[model samples]
Target chain A: EDQVTQSPEALRLQEGESSSLNCSYTVSGLRGLFWYRQDPGKGPEFLFTLYSAGEEKEKERLKATLTKKESFLHITAPKPEDSATYLCAVQEAKSSYKLIFGSGTRLLVRP
Target chain B: SAVISQKPSRDICQRGTSLTIQCQVDSQVTMMFWYRQQPGQSLTLIATANQGSEATYESGFVIDKFPISRPNLTFSTLTVSNMSPEDSSIYLCSVEDTREQYFGPGTRLTVT
Candidate 1:
């Protein structure tokens, strides 16, 4: 069974505060890991796709890093607009692109 | 990347009724998928919408309850039959071009 767990279900950070959200996964075979941002009542928007361990990607103030057993989404000096539910998903190597997603970490950036 | 458009952004339906959600992609796609998300929960895959074959449903989901149709490479529809309060959720349509998948805006369903 493939499972994904995220830490800090909810976090409230003041503006310019930095924090990192964790996504720990256990799968039969690792293919790829994905990160997304979803707003209220909307579907997830694509973020970064991590293919292998020790890989990192960044966009603006958001940076994502991948490890052997987990992935981290780091928010550096986040703005109010960056507040949303950040989701982590893992796709198994043998499966046909079906993703198992984490419960997600809700980030609230207060300005 | 594919751009997916889902119709009827939301709806309020009575119990035992049915609702069909449509997804149209801007370009050709090899695979289409449906997902369900309950309030404050993670997304669960419902089925794979194959163009020329019957859909493959995930565990706990059946074709009798949720039927899917993929008429072509860029279009598909998912119908939720015999709606209930438990069925009220966010239904999302996704298309996979290669290794990555893109999602629709989502349909928010509220069953009474």
Candidate 2:
């Protein structure tokens, strides 16, 4: 069975604090790993997609790195606006455009 | 990136009533999906809306309970039938383009 697990169910960080959220997965064949940020009462917003084990992607204050068994979303000097639930999902190579999502890590960056 | 929009941002319905949510994408997408999120829970895919064909439902979801319609490439609808308090959730629609998926704002449904 393909499964995705995200650790640190909830995190409270002061403004400008740096932190990393973890996502571990078990799948038949890894096709793609996705990162999304969802605000309260809204749907998720697309962040990054990592396809290979050694791949990494970055935005302004966010960086995502991938490994064979896990993935990390590193937040640098996060602001209160960065507070949101971060979601991780994986696509199985054998599946047809379907994503298996993790429980997600709720982040709060207090100012 | 594609921009997706959903109608009826939020609604409160009585038990046994039904509600339909609409999703519209800015551009034509090859794949579209519907998902449900309970309070503080992660997303659960309900079905894949395929244009010109019947929607493919997930394991726990059924066509009779959640009917989906994909009449074109950029628009789709998801109807929650026989609503109950358990059906209160945020329903989201996503479009897959290339290898990335973009989501809409979502419809917040409150069943009472």
Candidate 3:
């Protein structure tokens, strides 16, 4: 069965603190890994997509790296505005355009 | 990225009633997806709506309980039948644009 597990259910960091969230996935065949940020009472916003091992993508203050079995979302000098639930999902190579999502990590950057 | 919008951002309905949520995209898309996000849980794909075809529902979901309609390439609707406390969730619609899916604001439903 394909499954996704995210570590550190919740994290509280002071402003400017940097950390990384982990997403471990088990799939029949890896196709793509995605990262999204969701705010309270809102829908998820697309962040990045990593397709192969050693692939990395970065935004303003966020960086996502992918490997054979897992992915990591690293936040650098996170501000309060960046506080949101970070979600990770994976697509199986053999399946159609469907995504299996993780429980997500609730991040709070306190000012 | 496609710009998506959902109607009736939030609503409170009585049990056994029904609610229909609408999703519209700025551009034409071949595939539109509906997802359910329970409180504190991850998003789960309910069904995939394709233009000119029956919606493909995922396992643990049924067409009778959750019917979907794809009238055109840019619009779709998901109706929650027989609402219950378990049906209280955030319903989101997304469009596939070049391997990336963009989501709408979502409709928050509360069943009482």
Candidate 4:
């Protein structure tokens, strides 16, 4: 069975505080890992895609790094505007484009 | 990236009724998918809307309950049938572009 798990179900950080969210997976074969940010009552917005171990991608104040069994989304000096539920999903290599998603980590950056 | 939009951003429906959500993309896409997010739950794949063919539903989902239609490469519709309180959720549509998926604003449904 392919599964994705994200830790720290909820986090409250002060504005300008940096933090990291974790996503661990168990799959027969890894194809890709994805990160998304979803605001209240809205669909997810794509943030980054990590395909292989040791790979990393960054956008503005967010950086995502991947490993063989997990991925990390590091937020540097996060702002209140960046507060949202961060989602993690994985694609199995043998399966179609289906994505198995984690429960998500809800972050609140208080000003 | 592709820009996607959905109609009826939010709605409240009585139990046993039905509702249809529409998704439109800015450009033609080969793969379009529908997802459901139950209250406080992660997103789950409902089906893949294939153009000119019957949709491919994921496990735990059925066409009879959730019918999908893809009339063209850039448009799709998903209908929730025989709705109940348990069916209240956020329905989202996404398109695959350049090996990445882009999502629409989503339709928030509340069943009474």
Instruction: Judge candidate 2 against the unseen true structure and give its global Cα lDDT, from 0 to 1.
Output: 0.95
Position B61, candidate 3: lDDT? 98
Q: Please say which candidate is ahead in DockQ: 1 or 2.
A: 2
lDDT of 3 by residue, A6-96 (tens): 9889999999999999999999898899999999999999999899999999999999999999999999999999999999999899976
Q: Once model 3 is optimally superposed onto the true structure by TM-score, how far is the C-alpha of residue A25 displaced, in angstroms?
A: 0.4
Expressed as tens digits, the lDDT of each residue in B1-112 for candidate 2 is 9999999999999999899999999999989999999987899899999999999998999999999999999999999999999999999999999889899999999999
The local distance difference test score of each candidate is: 0.94, 0.95, 0.95, 0.95
lDDT of 1 by residue, B1-112 (tens): 7888999999999999999999999998879999999988989999999989999999999999999999999999999999999999999999876678788999999999
At residue A63, give the lDDT of candidate 4.
97
Error of 4 at A50 (Å): 0.9
Candidate with more favorable, higher DockQ: 1 or 4: 4
Worst 10 residues of 2 chain B by lDDT: B35-44
What lDDT tens digits, residue by residue, belong to model 1 across residues A3-66?
9999989999999999999999998888999999999999899888899999999999999999
Where is model 1 chain B poorest over a 10-residue stretch in terms of lDDT? Answer: B94-103
Error of 3 at B15 (Å): 1.2
TM-score of each: 0.98, 0.98, 0.98, 0.98
**Per-candidate total of colliding backbone pairs:** 0, 0, 0, 0
Candidate 4 DockQ vs. native: 0.86
Runs of candidate 1 with Cα error greater than 4 angstroms are none
